[model samples]
Target: MKTPAIAGLILASFALFSPACSQAGINLENTRVVLAAPSKEASLVIKNSATEDLMFQAWIESADKSEDVPFAITPVLKRLAGEQQQVLRILYSGKGLPTDKESLYWLNVREVPQKSREENTLQIAVQQRLKLFYRPAGLPGKVTEAPQQLKWRLLAKDGKPYLEVTNPSAFHLSFAAITLRMGSKGFTAPIDMVAPAATTQVEMAELPNGVQANSLKVELEVIGDFGGILKYDGAISG
Candidate 1:
């Protein structure tokens, strides 16, 4: 089982590792990348904070493993000196992608450190992945409002409790954590994402003993525009 901290680090676009971890030498200026409508491309900035020169390779792939994504990254491979920064441009081909809703992709940045021949020493390569959101023209609601537009409900299936969440808006709702409160008892669901105009169910576990699922209040901490987590509160529908 994965801990909440580890799961958050994986789903979150922001860098969660501390600077004391020398392996985490590359710093990203922005945690989330947004390509708005009427813009052909978006840019991301990466910096090398370590004293040694670092080699980096960046690429883009569909986060949901969809086929034929229409995005490309420039300067696929490069070397950055200490305290130096480089810009990565993501150009959209405007093909094989939807124009009615926001699309999601993952921007992977792999760091290769120069190998040392010293005995009894270890070197580790670091790979960072961030979210890339492609926004089309004229969506129903703003991306920032996605969390508030989610529909939540609690149901029992196969003798177990499950939380049903539906996203009615045109923006993807990526949640960092979800807390469901019923009277004096509360439980947190794992991190997950609900696609635009889609619904997903999460199995509830570790719930308080003898707690009822009906009339539960829901609180969600969702990923924001700048990679920070924002809170939203709502009640579960019957």
Candidate 2:
């Protein structure tokens, strides 16, 4: 156990520069993938921007690795010449996913290690894992409108303030940032994501002073299709 664990740490320490994973030479065309239902298939382009050839592999896995995943990717292993790109076809089974709300998975792409003959050689193979959302057909509101449907409220406990976010829409709501605003002053914090039909309390994003008596205006930076950030406004809920 100790030998393997210690060797893992040493290998990770040398991964200071990301070349094959998500950095300069190799890259994914998009940051996130949205698999809309009724299509059952999606694709991603892996590009080798460096001048040297590289090998890549891709796969889809559950966010929780222990769980069984229902996704498969074609061309799982491929070698791309310099300045070339390859497409990875992602196909989802028709069943085994939530129909009422979006489900989360991870698309993992990694650089395959190459055999090199050199003295004391160490190779860094980094894997890029991105958020993949699978949306079944005929859910609640449109994803564009889901951001506006979020409800928010402020609660003070232990002399600090916390914001409770309730997502009413069936689509999973991803918030990049939250802003608590008084009339003149505002503070912002990063709230990564919130699930559909669920409530989440964001901490460390401190509320503005005088939140107890006043209904603070809340602003959210929501992630939209194409991984773009969009702003939406809502008020404190009761």
Candidate 3:
């Protein structure tokens, strides 16, 4: 395997670690990787599920797609023979990242299949993209508490209802579902995730009949650090 460049790397939308094998027959042990300031590195297990040979190339890119990345990956490119697994380690630089909040990055692992011996056969190179989080040594609250610490409210723009939220924690919290619960009525908002110390607003779904907007409870399904879903009971601010 040769050193591959980040340039011309095709990326998939997004994927989580699962027991099901991928199109390229590659599987990751974890959905995401996290590196703390107290730690020097993190590792991921990459496995080739197929019985044939496959080439896997792993790389890191900033969440904002910045040119400068403060991390490096071991075995940037490797050939994994049938049903074999390899450990890919990610090393973080001591500096160049903000300590005030968790930084987000992407780990892109692309599977390069062996050249086709059959004539005119199609071979698709599959790539798996997972989220990577860089956390500082000391944060105000726990990662599990981030979802409940968020400030949620209902805002109106041009008579259209919108959901507004602010993250007070240094950790980035993602919401899989946000619902405004009322008496026998529920109006779900399409808002997904919010950044740390960031205020985000998204237009909510239309209010159902007989649903009162004055007293509404916020029900959030948060995505935790290890890819588990957690429930949060909250209320809108006055």
Among all candidates shown, the one with the greatest lDDT: 3
- In order, what lDDT does every prediction score? 0.76, 0.74, 0.79
Q: What TM-score does candidate 3 get on C-alpha atoms? A: 0.85
> Runs in model 2 with CA error above 4 Å?
1-24, 115-122, 208-210, 213-215
lDDT of candidate 3 over 85-114, digit per residue (tens): 999999997899988899998888988756
Error of 3 at 123 (Å): 1.5
Question: What does candidate 2's lDDT look like per residue over 1-238, in tens digits?
Answer: 0001111122322334543332336799888898998999988888998777888877777765645778888887798898999988888988898899999888878776565444344666667777889998999669999887887777776767777888888887776887877777777755788877888886544555445635578788887767789998887754
- Candidate 2, residue 56: Cα displacement in angstroms equals 1.3
Candidate 2: give its CA RMSD in angstroms.
5.0
Error of 2 at 176 (Å): 2.4
Q: Show the colliding residue pairs in model 2.
A: none
lDDT string, candidate 1, 1-238, tens digits? 1111121122122234432233557888888899987797999999998887888878887865655668878888899998899999999987767888889988888776565544333455677778899988888777787787788877777777777888899888777888998777668887578888898887787764344646578988888878898998977875
Candidates 2 and 3 compared by TM-score, better number: 3
Alpha-carbon RMSD to native, per candidate: 7.2, 5.0, 6.2
Would you give me the overall lDDT of model 1? 0.76
- Candidate 1 regions exceeding 4 Å error are 1-22, 208-214
